[model samples]
Target: MLKITHNTISEYLSNRTFSSIEKIQKENNNKKYLLLLSFLLLLFIVVQFLPWTQNIQAKGEIVSRFPDQGPQTVQTIIGGRIEKWYVKEGDQIKKGDTLVFLSEVKSEYFDPNLIQRTQEQLNAKDLSIGAYENKVSAIENQARALEQALIIKKNQTQNKLVQAKNKIEIENAELQNINKNNQIAQNQYQRIRSLYQKGLKTLSELQEKELKYQETLAKVSIQQNKLNNAQNEYYNLELELSAIERDYSEKIAKANSDKQSALSQSLEGRAESAKLRSSVSNYSQRQKMYYVTAPQDGYVSSLISTGIGQTLKEGEEIARIVPDKNNIVAQFKLSPQDIPLVSKEGKVRMRFDGWPSLVISGWPETSTGVFEGHVIAIDQFLTSDGYYRVLVQPNDKYKPWPIELRMGTGTQGFFLLKTVPVWYEIWRQLNGFPADYYREDSPETKKK
Candidate 1:
């Protein structure tokens, strides 16, 4: 009985020792797992505090930074039929290079020598204007000659009037003298008769005095007639002077009327000539418009009118030209809610289509195959798609953009904002909050 009790006690001791060893081993294994879990928790906490760049995402396409350097559509100022093509699609051309030749489609411009014919018409009009000008000049000269002739005629008429007045005065003086002689002779004849009656004078003497008295009377009558004739001649000379003035006035009036008519004709001809000149200039310009030329250095992207005889309306688009890709930019569309987060010169990271990229939304520094750019412009108004457009250009401070990039290529852009803790970004994103507002020149940024 004592031996059986001793064996049972030995077995119990051995089992106790084995169970203690297994417990110790299990405790050691649990301690190692606990240490590993603690290390992992500390690592997670540290990562949350790491710096994260807040960014606003956007989608866009590549375009030209300058409007003039963008795509342009070729058009014609006047409608015409395509006569020939100087270039095909995708042809590189310089400014003023002809793309197509057009023929006039309108009946008014159908004549092959339209410009030359218009020019000829203009020349004829000019010649007609010159002839009118010459006629006007001749009429002016005639008016001057008529005026000078009138002055000469008036002077001659005045001189003739003065001569007539002097002749009349001389005749009046002769008549007065004859009358006086007659009176004297009459008195002598009466005295001789009285003497004869008193037998103191001879009859012959009385007869001689009577004869002399008769002669004096005859001379008086002749002188009176001469005075009347002189008066009549003076009156006729006055009438003649009046008639000359009237005749000259009529002639001058007729000349003035003719001159006015010529001047009016000249004015009309000048107006017509001016119209013709304008027509000629317009035709000449139209002739030059027959050849459609490139507005700048570009490649012909497309031809809207392909057929040789296709007719184009006025101001219709003919083809599209893609200007040389000298200054490429990414045009990004941002949400209105995020517009306030972006500003001019804001840093941006772009991933172009067909380029491999790995992006970390909160850690842009670790991103690969992404291009750097800066915000150059932002639209004040919303775009057609209800989003604001943001223009981004290559960052001069960093690497240049890829040369193989083409216009209209799709792109994904992120506008970098304030740096914050990853925990904050995660919290804000969870709460659907916007990025924090901060100026680039803020005191905090400057200090950093």
Candidate 2:
């Protein structure tokens, strides 16, 4: 009986041990399931926070940066049919470079009468200039000749004046002789009269003495007339001298005035000549328009859009130039919300897609080096594609960029956005409004 009881107890003990092992195994399996669930929950929480944590910068709007480009170009000055083209598209040009030749045809609508009138006016100006020149020359010659004659006449008058003075001296001497003779004749007549009174002379002798005295008086009178004539002749010569001197002075003054007038006329002639020369030069340049030359050193591009022998009007477009094909930029699209951040003078930081780790900061560059630029403009109006485009400018100063940035290159780029409060997103969501709707309107509307 003791051996049987021992056997039963041993079996029961073994059973109990087996059951405990099963319970332990079940607990281990449950703990493992719980642990797996906990790990999954933790992973989900971490994944939700990954985007926020990766970029801690305040969330705002993303925008595009538009860059400055080369100067704008146009084609025609005055409307005409293109005769020839000096350069095709993609040709570089300097200032004052000729690009195209235009055939200028006389306007069919122009009035023939007006043309005739202009021609008549030009002919009249020519004739007037010639006539004025001839008149000025003739007046000048006449003045010179008159001046010489006046000088000669003045000298001759001076000599005549001297001769008249000599004649006056001679007449005065003759008058003095006549006066002496008259005085002697008067003494004789007085003595004859006294003798007649004293009966010492006869009547015939007294009469003869009186007649001699009268004759002496007549001679003295003639001498006096001669002296008066000499004086008058001298005075006339002086007057003539004075007149000639006045005339000479006047003629000389006129001659000098004519010289000045002639000089002025010559200046007018020079001005006219210059005007004609300028007109002729302009016409000649127009005629040379038939031949077009390369304005600068550059490669000729295909005339894809515009062709030669095409009629164009004023301010028309003929061709374009790709100064350096190696100069290229990436063009991308942005949302309307990005407009404000990318202003005309705002700075841009760019990085090509698929290479974010290698960021092109401060400025987007084409291969020569990192280039600096500012935002130029933005298209507020949405395009048909619902995406607004942004333009990037490569550094033009660093020409001949690497092969990757050539004109016909494919590039990808991204524009940086301005930062704002993180709560603004929640606010916009709650209000059923866009993130930038408030900014789009005035301050009063923002509050509303």
Candidate 3:
């Protein structure tokens, strides 16, 4: 019985030991899975603390740095039919190089000798102006001659008046002497008659006194008549002087009127000539316009008006030219919320459409096939597509852009901003918050 009891105890112990070993093995296997899960959790927490570069992504197209350096359309200002083509698509040309020759399409400019005919008209007007000028000059000379004649005639009339006045004075003196002689003869004749009556004088003496008295009376009458004639001659000289002044005045007035009329006509002719001259200049310039020239040195990209003999209206586009291609830039549009985050001189990473690239959004150092650039400009106004525009250019401190880059090529740009921990970035994104705003000179950025 003792032996059987001991054996049973041993068997029981052995079974318990085996069961415990199995349970231990199962626990160890479960611990192995738990340890792996804990290790993965710790690794994820550490990765969340890693640095991440915050960036804004935008799609854009390559363009010229300047508007004038971009593709431009060539146009004409006058209506015409294309006569000949001096250049074709893809031809490189300099400024002022003729691209096309055109012929007049309007009737007003159809004359083959339009400029020459206009010039002839201008010349004829010039001749008319010259003739009027000469007429004005001749009229002026005539007026001056009339004035001189008036002065000379007035002087001659004045001289005649002086002579007449002198003659009147002489005649008046002779009349006074005759009157005195008559008085004396009258007195002697009376005395002779008294003597004859008293018989104290002879008949011959009385007769002689009578005859002398008569002769004195005749002399006085003749002297008075001469004085009257001299006075009449002075009056006639005054009238002739007045007539000379009146006649010359009329002549001078007529001459001055003629001069003024000629001057007016000359001025009118000059005005007409000025109009003709303007027309001639316009025609000459129009003739030059027949040859459409390049506006700048460029390659002809396309021809809008192609066929010879095709008619084009005024201000019609003729062709397109692509100017310098060296100054290429990327134009990107950003949302309104992103405008405040973008600034001039901000760093950017770009991936061209045709180039293969592997992008790690938060790890720029790990990115491949991406080019570096910087913000050169930002638009103050919203674009037509309801977004703000930003301009990015190649960063000189980075690798040069691909030479195969062409204008209008598609580009994807990443505008880099402040750096932060991956956890914070993820948290901010979860909360719909903007990236942390930091100035370029901030200590936090400098520390990075």
Best by lDDT: 3
Q: Model 2 off-target regions past 4 Å? A: 1-74, 83-101, 107-148, 173-177, 246-268, 291-309, 325-349, 352-448
Off by over 4 Å in 1: 1-22, 108-110, 113-123, 164-246, 270-288, 431-433, 438-448
lDDT of 1 by residue, 1-448 (tens): 3565434555456644788867887899999999999999999999999999998888899998778988889989999999999999989999999999999888987788876887788788778878877887887788788889888988898898898899999999988888899999999999999999999999899899999999999999999999999899889888988888888788878878887887888788888878888887898889899999999998999998889999999999999999885689999988888998898999999999999999986788899989999988999998788999889999988878889999899999989999999999999999998889866778977777
Candidate 2 residues 266-382, lDDT tens each? 678767856765655555555564434443344445453255667776666555443332334445566665454454544444333223244332113322232333345556678
- Candidate 2, TM-score vs. the true structure? 0.53
Q: lDDT per prediction?
A: 0.88, 0.60, 0.91
Query: Model 3, range 1-448, lDDT digits (tens) per residue?
Result: 2555434555456544788867887899999999999999999999999999999999999998877888899899899999999998999999999999999988988888887888888899889889988988888888899899999999998998999999999999999999999999999999999999999999999999999999999999899999999999999999999999999899989988888888898898889888888988899899899999998998999999998899999999999998745589999999999999998999999999999999998999899999999999999999888999999999999999998988989999999998899999999999999998766787978887
- Give the Å error, residue 35, model 1: 2.9
Worst 10 residues of 2 by lDDT: 51-60
